[model samples]
Target: MQLDDLRQNWETFGAENPMWAIYTGRGRIEWDEGEFFATGDTEISEVMAVLERHGAPSGAARALDFGCGLGRLSQALAAHYETVDGVDISEPMIEGAKALARQPTGVDESRLRYHLNTKADLSIFEDESFDLVFSLITLQHMRPEFSRSYIAEFCRLVRPGGVVFFQLPTHRTTALKRLRGAAGRTMRKVRRSLLGGEPVMEMYGTPRKDVEALLTTGGLRVLDVLPDELAGPSWQSFRYLAIRPDSGD
Candidate 1:
């Protein structure tokens, strides 16, 4: 799908069922306010622990959460960093995130902020603006050209000595699954062309080699690539852990 199609689909999802769209396992009316944010805490805690093991990102002053649907991960990052910024493509999602942050139970309003960015690149934020640049289950939805550019942006946005962690599928694990994925994409294209109604969700992958080369081109040092379950059962996905080499001043 193109960027406009992605934005339209996610905007609808954000308006109708923000929480359910981010985490599909939850029912539309079933997301408990407290429990939903708590999942963010758990996820960020695990991510921080992993980073700690590698001695990453010399400081924890600021963080940026790309594609931060309703600030789920952004709010959680606030506990570790002094401030957190959440950027999303949908206006409703950003508005919902701001509203949630106003509550007493939400992350401190002063420490967390949300931004609406519909552009393909993160030009709104200056280079090396964050100690940790993160994205989760966000890149797989867009085509690789867009996703690759964002990955390069992740590398640029992170401060020297900081880390960039994101997930993307490399390919389907089985031939049947590959056929199914191709067929699904073809059907979605046909549906969009013929019906032109609600936006359909799509999945795309960048080969591992291309991803590594992109990171290298962005001047990030590949640290580790861990297999992750975020891409679902049919696809083989991985979370890349990389760091920008510190500049000797």
Candidate 2:
């Protein structure tokens, strides 16, 4: 699909169900700001623990949350890094993220900022700009070309000895299930055209080897490929952790 197609679907999602869109594919959440923000705390904490377990002990000075929805992770990430910038393709999502990024009275929200990104590649950033690059449950929504290009950008944006953590689907359905999904995609497209409701959000899978090669080309050393059941076992999700080679700062 074209970039605009992807953008349209997510923008529609953000406009209609900002909360549910961020935490996608799940059934309706009760939809309160308190619980919503709390989930962000939980996710960043879990990711921090995972990073520590993998041998990165120190925290980042600057971090980037790629495809960060509504600034949820960015708020939690600010505690780990001096500054955390969340970037997304949708304007509505970024607006929601900015609204939530505000701290209470006398508290500074400078550590967390959200930006709206329209480019497929992260050309907006300089080389080696971030100390940590992170994305979760986001890349799988884009086509492999977009994901692969962004993988390179993620690595390029991280400074030496920095980390790149991201997740993508590594498998696809086969046999009858594949047939059913193809039909479902067509139906969703038709419905979207006819009814003008929420656009059909499609998921794409990328091969593990292809990702590793992209990281290598992007000047990062492959660390580990952790299996994630976020999209369930049938979908085969995985998290990749890579580091730029250099002495720790």
Q: What is the TM-score of each candidate against the true structure?
A: 0.95, 0.91
Per-residue alpha-carbon lDDT of candidate 2 for residues 1-249, written as tens digits (9 for 90 to 100): 678888888888888888987775556555777777777788788888888886653454888999988877777788788888889999888887877666451114677777888899888889998888999878988878899889988988998878899889877656575576568878877887888756767777888899999999988888888888766445777889999988653
Question: Residue 103 of candidate 1: its Cα lDDT?
Answer: 78
Count of backbone clashes for each model? 0, 0
lDDT (C-alpha) at residue 176 in model 2: 72
Residue clash pairs of candidate 1: none
What are the lDDT figures for the candidates, one per model? 0.88, 0.81
RMSD (Å) of each candidate, 1 decimal: 1.7, 2.4
lDDT for model 2, please.
0.81
Give stretches of model 1 more than 4 Å off.
Answer: 25-29, 58-60
Highest TM-score, which number?
A: 1
Q: What's the residue-level lDDT of 134 in candidate 1?
A: 92
- Candidate 1: tens digits of C-alpha lDDT, residues 113-207: 89999999999999999888999989998999999999999998998888898989999899998999899889988988998876667878889
Angstrom error at residue 90, model 2: 0.3
